[model samples]
Target: MSKGQPNEVTGRIFDGATLRKILAQVQPYRGRFVATGVLVVLLSGLVWVRPALIRIAVDDAMPTGDADLLLNVFLAVCGMLLFEALLQYRVTYLANWVAQSVSLDLRSKLFQHVAQFQLRYFDKTPVGTLVTRHVSDIDGIANVFSNGILNAIGDLLALLVVIGTMFWVDWKLTLLVLTPIPVLLLATRIFQRVIKKAFVDVRNQVSRMNEFVQEHVTGMHIVQAFGREKQEAKAFAAINASHRDANIRSVWAFSVFFPLVEMLSATSVGVLLWWGMQDVLVERMTLGILLQFILYVFMLYRPIRQLADRFNVLQMGIVNSDRVFKLLAREERIEDTEMARAPEQPIQLRGTIEFENVWFAYTDEEWVLEDVSFRVEPGESVAFVGPTGAGKSTIINLLNRFYVHQKGRILIDGKP
Candidate 1:
């Protein structure tokens, strides 16, 4: 439950500080980020053009038997589709490029940060936990850029454009088409909350499985030597089952949510048809406008559905960002401050070592070495003779500065 620990699952979906940190990674890729934004905007605007061209072909060109006008509109629609496709490619490529770049930088930074951590930190933390942060969690952040944030923005813009066009064609039908939206929004809100928890559990379970597998694999020799293979296998099975169940929960949430979105979408289209058909029969609304509205209805609902999925991606990314940033926040490394400054000129090593009344402990509960004192003069061969856990290795570790002594001075060549 400590900070940076992957197993800690909280209900909150977004952390502002974590988001700011994630965005800070994009400062180096601002050009690509801006370019992707512009492309997304262009794509959103271009979406309306195709339907407008179709409306012109159906209502105006067909009625006058103007084959030339119909051909021109068809060409225009085709050109727009091609142009949209091109923009989409650029957006997708640039977004992924930036994402990969950012992830690379983050992974390197996380690795360097972890490298500077003290041996005690490694002793207390699992290697698999760090592996998850470096590998899977960073990939989650990459997805935020490539699939979550930019795509969600594009979807929102497309949704707005579709709704605006629907209203322009016929405000009454637009209002009717939107009747199911409130219900859909409610379902989405519920789904978001449920899936956020599920995703958090999924992430936690992934970290657990990683830790379990890594520990067992590294200790496989000990497992076989101690005849604990069956017990370890049973433990692994339990961890695997937990991982499976967590994934299934997230999948179940998706199954329910997407179908509800599709059902609401279908119902909206049905109601639009049933109600607008009367206007069509009376010649109050043109067949082209009704057709345009139908297209707009699909356009509007598709993005809404996608937005929910995108939000889940963003949610998972945020969860990862929180954990990764917390790991970066930890400062457990030994600090060689100004007070411990080395001499401007290199000192000649005389092979003299001294430990004066030193006290050391890996933890506060018990002392590994207490009130110890020793001196090995230059050209003297001193042997440290003791059983295991008798401060033998601790003495060497203290002299090498791997762990700082709690009380007293360790001097090299009489320099403390």
Candidate 2:
């Protein structure tokens, strides 16, 4: 969890504590959150209605020569479709609104937290790495609220409703049509496992690339002065290649999994046609019911296929959240106790400065200043002359309270 270290991928896709932290972000927008949930459930529950209406029009209205009933059913289907569209719009808008609001809040909090951190923290952490956290990682967390977890829940519910309705319509047909589902499920499980790792690698590579570019760009003068432009470009190319490879792995998983889903969907249709024709020939099932099963098969597989994708989105969000939270958890900020605060009113001073038995280190046991002592009387102009890396700047930093000396009594105006 150290700064600049790659995040470790957990065996589980979602962490409970992480999930709770994410949901906690929704507290301020609870009304929108609740409304989104309700709409998703409502939309899922109504998934079977249109198919049922289509069956009724085909079998009952048309066969009975009831033109009035046919017209009414058509109009009803149109109305239902429109209603679902409106509900979808509200859900999309509400989810994104909550997500964007939460994103803004988190970004602002992170910025303030990072700004207060000690210079030692920044010395060890790369600017590009922090940039990745502020930009790409936060975007991933936003996606969790907008399109990841919530949409995945809706897809799962719609899937169950579609399957349940299929069973109700004709249990035998449903069973036969679902024969290919086990294979599809197995494929999806593999895809999820593979893609999660790929995504984690992608994020890691992105951070590395960001860090490399940031450092090189900021030090372009050094690189040019040392005639190391080609060397730096080669290093950047290697990092960029790693990022590309990681993305290709994720793309490869999608390429394989989606085609497999389509093939399974087609197989289910074939199964339906093969078994349905037998029943139709024997007058045990009507054409209208067979057609309904076809539609139902599509509904069943569509959500199942989407479920895999949505799960990936959720997984990526969790990965990014883990990184962001780790950064937030760092205790690198200087704590200003009550005694450290400046007085409300300014007071004149004689300007005497003293550093008594000061010991300091930017890192563990690597002392930049070892038991150093100094004094500057009023009106005395003292210059700290030293070679590079000889604690000259460290002295100024300690005097300014930019860092706390490990063991020291730094007194200004005879005050300690």
> Which candidate leads in TM-score?
1
**What is candidate 1's lDDT per residue for 227-297, written digit by digit as tens?**
99898899889989999999999999989989998899899989989998899899998888888888888
Per-candidate TM-scores read 0.96, 0.95
Which parts of model 1 have CA positions greater than 4 angstroms off? 1-6, 337-343
Candidate 2 has an lDDT of 0.88
**Model 2, runs deviating above 4 Å:** 1-3, 7-11, 342-350
By summed lDDT, the worst window of 10 consecutive residues in model 1 runs over: 1-10
Q: Model 2 over residues 159-191: C-alpha lDDT tens digits?
A: 999899988888878888989888988998899
Angstrom error of the Cα, residue 356, model 2: value is 1.1
Query: How many clashes in candidate 1?
Result: 0
